[model samples]
Target: MGTWGTSIKDNDAFADVYSEFFDFYNKGGQPEIISKKIIEDNWEILEIEEEKNSLWFALALAQWETKSLDPKIISKVEEIILSGVDLKIWLSLGASEQDIKKRKIALDKFLEKIKSDRPKAKPRKRKKLKTPIFATGDCLVFKLSNGNYGGAVVLATDNNPETAYNLVVTTRLNQSNKPTIKDFQNTEVLICNFGQWQDKADVTWYMPDLFYKDYADIYEKIGKISVDLEYDNKNHDGKGYLFKPSWTACWGMNNAADKQFESELTKPKPKKTLTIKQLTKKEKWWKVF
Candidate 1:
């Protein structure tokens, strides 16, 4: 979350890394210039976006494909194993379960090969969150006890869900009548597109059926709903969300989506049909056939 979060703002560098990663994959699985050291040095940038999952796993795959390995390379491989990124997320990158299994085996063997050369370091494991970190631009779908369903875009994420749930969601509803992060239950969270909110005038509430049907393919299961993420008025003597006085009514959300909502809702314009008079004689004659 340090420098890794900031450096990906450069679109050029992002595109280069993305294309180079694919190119490296195509030419050979071996990492010639993009060694473990290079990845380690630029770790902040590489792991900046959601692409971090892909970047880490790709390195693992490339390492496995390389024919020869030195102690230094093995050490770097070890660093990858110790990195907190989950190897399973590679599945989301189109890797099959069998391939992931082989990758794990290869990683294990590589680690064993270098055991004598370097002492084993403690593995850095990621904490199993009650709910996965709901980062900005994530999609959230919920079905409450009332049996209604709807979804929204995550405007921001709260790393620590203990003290306060830091979910700032951007909905289709106007800023005046939007649901706070607390107003959900039996929630089903999905890792949708890397989209953000933009252009307030464009925001409007979308019915449940329309949304799920339209964007059905992009959603992936990330985690479950937190039972108590929303603040309860009963618990804090009628204090609202985040225990702030201003949040006592209408929750803390206000015109949050007015600024903008950058999402995948841009529908393509329909192709215009040619009128009979506008068509050439030859084209019209062919159409008759």
Candidate 2:
């Protein structure tokens, strides 16, 4: 838990940084020259705010502290800080509706000042949006270790499942070369559905690379694998895949999803048995010899 006094101190530390930047700007010094060093020093300090509260204030502080050392920069920083203060006041202590209204008015004035002085650039044209390759309510293919394959239906909405989605599949061979889809043999494919809010839907896949060691291995082989999928969205035709054993896939979310899948995998499997009469019938057939 953090105290109110700590928040005040953090706020003051940010203010001091803003003051120093303002001083430099007023002196007609170049702020961009020291921007990198200043940012490195303040990164941890920024984390303090990021952990304790909203990142909006921290971003404003960063913008102020790193703005070009010029008169305009100082003015922009002050405007941003004032706007942040207004936002904090509104979110912190309970204020009367009238007080909220008044704060918003002041905040609007500060924003107007910022807009008047800020540099303008050409507006970017919007690109056409494509239907996501992976989406919610779609069946996904995954490889297992026994020279075989498995699949699951994607339950959560995935606006960008290829990059943002997390998943958990049952198999071994953390490395790509060791266990290809051919390794998954005689293993039952267990499919589980998870909602967007479910914790299990958040696992990410990790891969190995010589240069970038932190990368996750999402794709295993060069060739594509084909699989069937069912989609909730109506516009796109639902089922298709490119080739055999498409790529190494992993859940994109947190470890919680992995744990959930493991629990599901651990459930008892039903056993097969033969009755005595059936056994006797087989014996009778052998007795003819």
Candidate 3:
């Protein structure tokens, strides 16, 4: 139900699988090895029918694109396509006749595309990103607009320098007054909420090198405060928004979009939304949902 459309690439399960495969491949992992690793990593999902189909579909596509398609994987994908279980699931889920027709065509097209040989995309030498710019729990302030101070706290840092990034969240720093270190602990995480999650947005990033060169004299390290990011999650129908703990940079957010975020977040506004309450209500940083 995470799917939004009939396209093979339209679901979160497919996006997660395909992207992870390429992440490993681009980092110099072998296709066969990466494929096996994905299979092993998602063993639990493999037990479910729809998820099982998504796995095969995604892995077959990735392997085909890399010119390392496995015979067994292709066979599994072919069976899933011909079995029409995906469309059946769609029908069971109340998909209209028109939607079911589109899904059927999508499945056929995917099968044909993977059967054809694709030019191999060569893996490049990757420079794993730099070490996290700030340590976990480091609260910092930056002067973005004239005379305005914006606050952010490092929520977490990764161990691998290649993928290590300082995951930070912006705080509700009012436009006119500078907040005391203790005030930051009371401030809410600034977020763009528009009823549904599809309308949610955020600006985040590791400390880019330009931080010193471009934002020099504006960045200040404040006293540390503990924080865990609360993300907006959408329902299957994309109708409702749910606040969940988000601990990684991979959440859908624009890198270095802080300047734009500051425009609205730095404005003086009373807290009335759900994220602050959710944070205080039995929320654990590591909880996935």
For model 3, how does the per-residue alpha-carbon lDDT over 1-289 read when each residue is reduced to its tens digit? 2323466765445656776787888778899999999999988768865556777888998898888999999988888789987888766645558768988999999999999878775455465565656776676776533466667666556556555555555665645566567766676666653212232323243433223433345457778755454322222222332433332223222212232343335443333443333432345658966
Using lDDT as the measure, the top candidate is 3
Runs in model 1 with CA error above 4 Å? 2-19, 27-30, 34-57, 66-71, 79-289
lDDT score of residue 128 within candidate 2: 30
Cα deviation of 86, candidate 2, in Å? 7.4
Query: How does each model score on lDDT?
Result: 0.34, 0.33, 0.59
Summarize candidate 1's per-residue lDDT along 198-222 as a digit string, tens digits: 1111111111211233334423323
Ranking by lDDT: 3, 1, 2
Local error of candidate 3 at residue 170 (angstroms): 18
Q: What is candidate 3's TM-score against the reference?
A: 0.50
Q: On a 0 to 100 scale, what is the lDDT of residue 94 in model 1? A: 37
Ranking by TM-score: 3, 2, 1
Q: Between prediction 2 and prediction 3, which has the larger TM-score?
A: 3
Provide the lowest-lDDT 10-residue window in model 3: 248-257
